[model samples]
Target chain A: MPIITIRLAKGRSVEQKRDLARAITNTVVEKLDVNPEWVTVLFDEFDRENWATAGELHSDKYGKGFGKIGSQEYPK
Target chain B: MPIITIRLAKGRSVEQKRDLARAITNTVVEKLDVNPEWVTVLFDEFDRENWATAGELHSDKYGKGFGKIGSQEYPK
Candidate 1:
């Protein structure tokens, strides 16, 4: 089983997850030549207080509502 | 950085997570010889509806309140 775990900040909508799951499953199936049913995608959503970088918490560095767009680690 | 992700059924207590993080961090540090700060332990909690095995959803396979005591994938 190809278990793909994506670590992302919390607050993503269900639509985002649905789209991501489909896209990622398709990519994995095409690239690895595996069955789509064999692929599993798990989203690990983290709170700002729990996430840190360079010993600084994301809440302090990025303020609030950072996850809706992206994190400091993955600015978009 | 060594990021360790644990995919488990939801409903685990914070105490369980705290214990697991510390234990896993120590193990990673000892085995990989990495600093504790460089290791990240992320717990991915999935609802039964979102998790599946053998083409069957966990919610359907195990009924309700299945996550409180591990899952069919991990009998413990």
Candidate 2:
């Protein structure tokens, strides 16, 4: 069983999560030769305040919100 | 930098989470030679409905709650 955990800045919709879960499951099953039933996809959402890069919290660098529209590194 | 994600049944208190984060951070920093500030620990809480074992949903198999008091596999 492959347990995958994805970390992202919060604000994604349930539809996005559903799509992500499906895509990840498919990839893992194909690559690792595992059953879909054995794959676990976990989304670990982060508040900007709790996430940091280069010793600075994301809230200080990015203000708020998510995705690549205004992000310096993380792309959509 | 190492990003760690912990998947567990929901209902842990903030105090428990804080302790776990500290312990994990220390271990990662020591083992992986990473700075504590560069390590990220994310807790991914799951509902039993979303977790399954042996092709059975955890909710159906374990009922509710967390930890090992009544769990067959997951120990405290």
Candidate 3:
């Protein structure tokens, strides 16, 4: 089984998760030659307060609402 | 940099996370010879509805309240 873990900032809609799961399953199936049923896509949603880069928390460095729409750190 | 990701069922307390992170960071630092600051521990907490095994969702297979406590699938 192939488990794909995506770590991102929280606040994504269920619709986005659905899309990502389906697309990730398809990609894994094609790339790895595995069955779609064997592929699992797990989302790890993080609060900005818990995520950091270069010893600086995202909450303090990027401010709020950056992950929802995407920014330099989280490209669309 | 070493990034360790833990995939587990949801409902864990922040105290547990703090303990785990500290212990894991120490282990990684000693084993990999990396700085504690270079080791990143991420928790991927998944609801039963979003996690599945053997083509069955955990919500349907294990029912509710299994993940909160130690179960066959999740050991304490």
Tell me, by lDDT, which candidate is best: 2
Off by over 4 Å in 2: A69-76, B1-6, B11-44, B47-76
User: What is the C-alpha lDDT profile of model 1 across A14-45, one tens digit per residue?
Assistant: 55566666787788889998887797776667
| Model 3: DockQ vs. true structure | 0.13
TM-score against truth, every candidate: 0.53, 0.52, 0.53
Q: Is 1 or 2 the stronger prediction by lDDT?
A: 2
lDDT of model 3, residue B51: 63
> Model 3: residues >4 Å from true position, as ranges?
A68-76, B1-8, B11-44, B49-76
Tell me which residue pairs clash in candidate 2.
none
DockQ comparisons of all candidates to the true complex:
0.10, 0.10, 0.13
The TM-score ranking, best first, is 1, 3, 2
Worst 10 residues of 3 chain B by lDDT: B67-76
The TM-score, computed over Cα atoms with residue i paired to residue i, of candidate 1 is 0.53
Candidate 3 is scored at a TM of: 0.53
Find the number of clashing residue pairs for candidate 3.
Answer: 0
* lDDT tens per residue, model 2, A5-75: 67788776655666667777877788888898888766667888999989999788887778864644433
**What lDDT tens digits, residue by residue, belong to model 3 across residues A3-74?**
876778876655556666667777778988988778776666788899999999988877765444334343
Name the 10 consecutive residues with the lowest summed lDDT in model 1 chain A: A67-76
Compare candidates 2 and 3 on DockQ and give the better one.
3
